[model samples]
Target: MSIPVITLGAVASAFVPGLEQLRGPVTVVRRCEELAELVAACQTGLARAAIIAPGAADLTASLVDRLRFTGVVIIALRDHPPGAADPVVDGIDYVEASVEPAVLAAAVSRAVGRFEAESARPRDSHAYADPLGLPDVMVPQPPDATEEPGTGRIVAVWGPSGAPGRTTVALNMAAELAAAGSSVLLVDADTYGASVGASLGLLDESAGLAQACRIADQGRFDGAALGRIAVSVAVKGGRLRVLTGITRPDGWPELRPAALGKVLEAGRSLAEVTVIDRGFCLEADEELSFDTLAPRRNGAALRCLEAADTVLAIGAADTIGVPRLVKALAELDDAVPTATPRVVFNKVRAAAVGRAPETQLREAWERFGPSVRISAFLPMDHAAADRALLAGTALLETAPASPLRLAIAALADVPAAGDTRRRRPGQRPRNVKFPGIPARLPR
Candidate 1:
């Protein structure tokens, strides 16, 4: 039986006549006029492979991944020599447009053969499974012997709405971690409002997180690739690597949950600790209303929370903020049952809760909030915050002596297991305990 193949793009169509001449190895089933038609043809199971031009309309890494998920072997026909300027599309084989018809056929056969061989292999029962239930995606490799255990801990900074300082906490925490001599990768995973690049005084034009997700979706993510995409920011004591988030909200479809998971997996090999600044919403209503395969706007945040080793749930210190945080905590618990977020109240001040705000807030929390203990109370330091924002630098650099900076620095002292770095002499440790926070709230 001849292998059935579909062709798209003008460059690909030019080979149809030649391909049809050599009928034994492969057959041209349909010449699609557009990407949608090609996708539809592949979905109908009429084509085992698709040969598309690199310039096809709306061609993206996400589309390539979707086609591959349907078991369609993709071959890109390039009319020019490969160069640094050429866009790298992962998860697809490339063939020169000038290649002979026989050679093209051979390339398609080889790709299909490899795909079949991989599909037939015995599955590993203990391997990391895709929580999204995606098929044929690459399984992340296990840590090598040289890597220290528990080194690459993912700490996601999440908070309820009303500007509870999620980015502020995430950025400073990452800087503090780096200052302590640990390699850090600070990722802006907030699709709705990504400002890590802007916050650190770096160019926000390139969407580093989205680009990383594209590479990860193709199963090509590695330490070197991560290093290339991440911008290095020099902190006071050490340098921190950062992956900026999407430039626009419409780019959310690029940050699929499955790909984000892979990106986090690869991050373990790149940095000792990965701090993700997450968005506010955790609702999955899109999944309920649309097709199972439709993109969910809040999926990225939920995925990060689920994969985080530690979750820093921040909330503003006020009447409205406290109630919102309480409700959000319940929503988070329902969304990710395994997550135990360290509750943090930002902008804690006398104006918000009246005299001795910490005392009153703690008392009220004990009575009304979830059973989880409050981890940290960041004082309202509008001047320091404004200074840092104006300078486009972390508090560690802009206002090192600010009370807010001191609080974040203290939080970083509670290191991962096996981390024995001692605090500077005379630096007092904050009275915060991590053991009491229950994984699930009481019924």
Candidate 2:
């Protein structure tokens, strides 16, 4: 039996791509506003399916919810998706140019065949819904209940190999921003190992990334749920919302690229400044053949980098560290072709490198021709950092006078309290400022 044909009511120019893959009868309609006309057309009883672009201006939660008429299967087309390009929605089948048209035709044929499958096997709701008996399908509500351009600053702190203190810098940077009275969210996207919880002295027994993936999987992550999962740590006068990493490496696969991207996107929506704690850019070997226990997709961190407005690359100040930083710069160049990372030299205590660590890094990076700007230089102060970690406190609270803390503070002070400035293309950055060292930022 031939699969009944569907008419496509797409926002202008969007229907061409799917037509290549969809062999069924396709009627290219105009804008989202014409959905009503399309529905009226369906009343003629010729079309059994509708191909609608979710990006269409007329498409809305209300609109989709109303599309429950019998014998009509509504398929929403999105150009790109939550992770990769597999566009099959929970209820709708996706037809695209790349895949065999037969695959989609078969899917639609299955739906038509299954009109009686629900009644034939009348399973309880529990069979379809999750174990908790919640609704099986929970599509994400648009942020603010309306679609608008996002407004937030996301600074991703990434470094090269050899533990160049990416976490430390991220922690203090978030703290300093919060101290200056900016609402900040610190995300631990380090899929290899997440130390943000430990670094901040947070017990964080609750699900962080794992739960986030679950929520995102349902596509129902909202602003309120985002707040509930974020572990709060006291910064200067403000608070730091920390999203810790996955507890075990085995769960890494669950952190799908799209889900992680959604979490970050949602986080940015709620924060004045979002600081990300990323894993080593050089360590892509999260995938180990022998270790089924540890599947290193590294998807979470990479997604963060790709979505980042600014990336802060950390490098150790020592000879070995400098060379590694040089190479790490190369890797980031390839991995994130779209992003321009701000390079910072951490633990620059040795006078042997030069009096000015920033100048040295600038010189080295310039030779590579990537044009990296040295943003900040944090001196090495192991004693203070160790003491803070042991006490489960931040260096700002544990050792206010430490040179390392001061450097981080100075670097962090560049952005004004609640500055909300969007980064422009090809903008040059200057040193971050600190009015003066205080007893501490108000808690």
Candidate 3:
């Protein structure tokens, strides 16, 4: 098969003669001078491989990612020794500037072979069907896809952009799991804005999450090291370990994917249940920090959703919240497409959704997202929130019997016969009745 190729910059002149000799074998279909042209050429399927000078105008990581995503293999001309391509600027095979034309031809052939190998991988395995049997679900693909038959489940709590009370839900879930005698580990993983520690009045001085990431980065992370980083927080009848998030957003780069993955696997090994409280943002740009393999702020959230056995997707319950929730689910369809997330409504009130908000919400969700089922409903309790915030702890510690805590605890015991409402063939579950709010959220 003829491998169609493209070239940019003066490097093309050096390879054109050799490429001429192999014209029938390797076709130089396009000679692009501008980076934009290169992007367009790759995007429009004009070429399958590219040889670019490092000095090509506007050559960026984003462009490389787009090319790679679209099945175009890039070969960057580098000054490095020619054993293998440099991993720094992703999707590019490098050859020394002064390499022989034959050597350059061999490099192009090697890049094509490598590209074919990668292209042949089972990427479609990550695509799952939505509840309605719609084909566009993008679930996070695990590295070692061989899932064990029965392991203690990991539930990642994620919400939309707004403050939909994800930390509140995650804290109480971990606490509930602990009280049930399941060893639980509560992780605060918000890179943009972390409040799990603040919610519990935990200290902000020591960086537990960052420290764990550092140890994990060095390949020395373990359960014992996990204990060293995490702080023991007292709950109703037991204590659970909590790994606080980074002190600031600037520290997000430290939460590298390799490091974070190790921590997650280790958490499951230690705890019967691990509840990771994540941030709202879930953008997955494979080219993020492509040069150094640095972490993006949203990487942790994306990884959490993918790694977890289940996802607890929390959203606001008001009018704005409901519509936002619908849009968020649609976006999630593109992000973690294959994940069947259990949606929870937080801050449900009469002012925003009118009387019998649950009924209105149920119909709206059924209309907008036939496949997304409302799993749990938590009421807005300003007093309970205030008291817990003021006391520097979870609702279970201060307002255990409050409606809010009760609703959250119910969610924590999912699939336990009476705790959850499963969707039947033609209707909502029979035994479950969602708790409602007596008052609305005060201004």
Candidate 4:
């Protein structure tokens, strides 16, 4: 039986005549003039493979992912070698447009064979496998046979909405770790409001994290590639490797969970501690409304939490902030039951609670919050925070003796057990019970 194929665009049309002439291995089932028609044809199960031109309308990474999800192989015909001007799409096989019909047929057959093999294999529940079945072409191997790969600790800084000092905590913690001679990679994964670049005085508009995700989605992510994309910022104690977040909110689709997960994996091999500043929302409502394969806006934050060795759940100290944090903690427990986040209350002050604030806050937490323990309380220091913000640096750099800085530095001492218990790629995190909270909180 001949394998059915669809062709799109003028370049793809030129090959149809030759492909039909040699009809033993494959057959041209349809010739689509536009991307929409090609997508429709593929969705109807009319073809197993699509030969698309590079200039196909609305041929984005998301579209490519959707097409691949339908069990269709995409062969993108490239007019020339990929460069900065014309980058390669993530989940497509690029073949030289001038290749002969025989070569194209063989390529399609090989791709199909590999796809079938991958589909038959049992997939890991925690991570998504490359849709294209591409090998890890650029993964760095350890030099000595006896030496193990670097298993850096992943610390994710998360919080509820209303500016609860997530970025402030993440930046200082990473700086302190770096100051203590540990290599650190600070990633700004906040899709909604990405200000890590501007916060640290990095004026460059390049979306480092997005670029890394694209490289990761292509199965070519490595420590070297990460280094190339990330910018180095020198701090008081040491320098930090920073991966800035997306410049625009619409770029959330670029930070797919699967790709971001791979980037975190590579980050472990690159640094001693990887600090990620995550977004506020954890809701996966998109999953309920859209297909299982749709791009999730909050998937990036959830994925970071899942991969994190330690989760620093930050919240403000005010009346509104405390309740928000408590509610968010319950949601966090439901989202990733295995995650035991270290609760941190930022901007803590006597005014927020009564005099003797720590004692009052503790009593309230025990009554209203889940059974999780409070990790640290960062006192509100507006002057110090302002200085750091104005200087575009961490508190350690601006005011080392500030009370808030001291509090944030102490958080660095928390052990990262993930270094020792490195979960295998795509392996689900083992279920570890939270001390007091039940597996599922009352909704």
Candidate 5:
């Protein structure tokens, strides 16, 4: 039987003669000039298998998602071999770009058989969102009482581009959750500015996140492996396991697609609460025709939100920050509707929004997002925050009874339905190094 195919590359037209040599009626009938045209062909069900080159237009996760929805298998032609060191993302199969015509045909034939088998079976719930079926990092609360216990909670602490104390909240949240006798893993996932280590006084320059991502890229990231990368920090009642972000600014590419999620999945087995301090950018810039699995700084943050059981969408109290937060809320809803966010206002003061700041901020946010109520407003605590940062420790340790610590502790008290007793602080499951790092935080 014949198979339908679409070709997209600079020398795409030259491949027609080669495709015609297939023993079966293999048709390279459609040649897409632009990404839009290729997408259109896939939408109309004209393209079955796309033979795409390394740099064929802007191939984004969103586009790959679209193709997967319409039952299109992506056959990527790269200069490298398919193995542990390959730079390919999920949702696409890779073959050597310089392969002979006959070898290419074999790949296409396999793609057809794989597609037919997959299409015939019941559709996967995550087929369109994450077609590659990379490990489902999400540990959703068990629907019934019979569901698994001790599944950790993922709380993504995110906010707008302008500084709104996301790291502070994340650290405080981890501390509070730890104080409640839950093991915590605080991850610095803010690709734009990774300050969790510095805030906690850790100066080891280990680039823990980059190393974990490297291991994941090699497809050897499991729970045992995850334990090796984490640095232990004693909080209060329980310990805080930290996964430091990239060592440098341009190191975002180190965190490839599905890598961070694999780390999160691994962390769940060790911790009771996972606090991911995410970057400000939630935008999915999949419009670039690069590889569908291209390295994106914001992609890590997006995945954190996707896998989170609770999303703390925070923002600054005043003028510019409030407006950005409002716009961000709408974008968040459009992007990850599965994540039900709890809105928070950081650095709230009467001077920022005048008397009755909460009421005014609520009134302003109600226009754009009527259903999203301002759940909590963190008060301005300069002295306590400064002391914690300068001391290279958590606010709870510096000022245990401070208002800031109390506020975060209140948030930690939010009921978790399917939780079991967790380990205490300073309990090292994997003993690699000593406890704690001397942090340097930015004001």
Candidate 6:
């Protein structure tokens, strides 16, 4: 079968000479003003490929977004000058770097062939927004959870060393928010000891964030590509879109800082709340020693802090734990000066454990006052936590009534769910980046 081809509202002078060699049915428009009409006509499903001039002033990002929705291949003129007015975004399949007639035709043929193969297969909801303009496929946003157009929310969960329950807190918090009918995305941003997949019993097979970094290095990442990379977790009573961590610490280099920022931003667009499970250490160096995974430039965890609107500081409830948290709190101040850390003492057992844990924490904070906001307290329930972990489920699902789970759920303040555009004092703008060059390039 032959493929359908299209000309923009006006044919470029550069492409006119070789128009006859283009082997497809063509529809041409008179001028740039009619480009919309051409695009609209293409939506009737005839155009499989679009041939526009590099100098075509009518092309636009929105137009490309629309054509992309229709699953059409965009073939720009090969002779496009280096600084053409209309630059191609990353999603474009092939670019004819030269204006040769045969080369352009070959590129178009390849692009159309790939598009047809994709169209022949089942639809991929994650790769594209549904035809009817429905919410995103993998992580649909709740109708009431709308942001102020382009703004997004960020949530960060941090814990001191010694199994202070960061993942547990982040997972349950995200699940609770999702259950309340808000679209939530849970991200495991911990560079070291990223056990989100293991805690939930997900197979640690693919490197999701690595793939995203590769895409972002090419400057092509968007909401649609994000949905494709994020792994969807099916919670019993809740829905969560998760972007799991790298399988091994060595894989951290693949998770570029800029790409990670963009991925979080994209998650914010698709989800009402983005819950991040961060590494305990906020320092941006790989030399620090850790238990689970080796470091990759060591900036992954700290990057989460810089991006988060609210930072949840978690710590153990025992004697040594309190002092460690106090010290950790001091480090947090230096790392994220713009945001104050909120403290949560996990594994608190007032009955079986000593009553003095809270008192000690309060006293220590009095001397170290104003730096940390000691907020919630979670009691210890070792039996329930162990059972839930063994069953490959969260405490909320395995032991909903457990004191620890209840405490974590209560930490969900109204502001976290109500406000979607809040930002910390020091977070970088959405388009800016920290000091460093990107490490990976797109394949």
**Model number with the top lDDT:** 1
Worst 10 residues of 2 by lDDT: 122-131
Best model number under TM-score: 1
TM-score-wise, the better of 2 and 4 is 4
Pick by lDDT: 1 or 3, better one = 1
**Residue pair clashes in candidate 2:** 82-258, 140-219, 236-442, 237-442, 286-296
Those runs of model 6 whose alpha carbons end farther than 4 Å from true positions after fitting are: 1-150, 286-296, 350-353, 368-370, 414-443
Residue-wise C-alpha lDDT for candidate 5, range 338-443, written one tens digit per residue: 8788877878778988897767777778875548767777777888888888866777777765656555555555222222225366432221111111111100
Candidate 1 achieves a global lDDT of 0.76
lDDT of 4 at 388: 84
Question: Per-residue CA lDDT of candidate 2, range 258-284, in tens?
Answer: 767887777766676778888884445
**What lDDT is reached at residue 27 by model 3?**
75
lDDT values of the candidates? 0.76, 0.61, 0.69, 0.75, 0.69, 0.62
TM-score of each: 0.71, 0.58, 0.60, 0.69, 0.60, 0.60
Candidate 2 lands at a TM-score of: 0.58
Say what the RMSD of model 6 is: 15.6
Q: Give me the runs in candidate 5 sitting further than 4 Å from their true place.
A: 1-150, 287-293, 367-369, 414-443
lDDT per residue, candidate 6, 23-128, as tens digits?
5433322223345555665555566677765555445566665575454667765454545565556545435446566666667678867755543332233322
Error of 6 at 188 (Å): 0.7
Error of 4 at 265 (Å): 0.6
Which residues of candidate 4, in runs, are more than 4 Å off?
A: 1-6, 9-34, 37-150, 285-293, 414-443
Clashes of 5: 13
Which regions in candidate 1 have their CA more than 4 angstroms from the true location? 1-5, 8-37, 40-49, 52-100, 103-151, 285-293, 414-443
Better of 1 and 6 by lDDT: 1
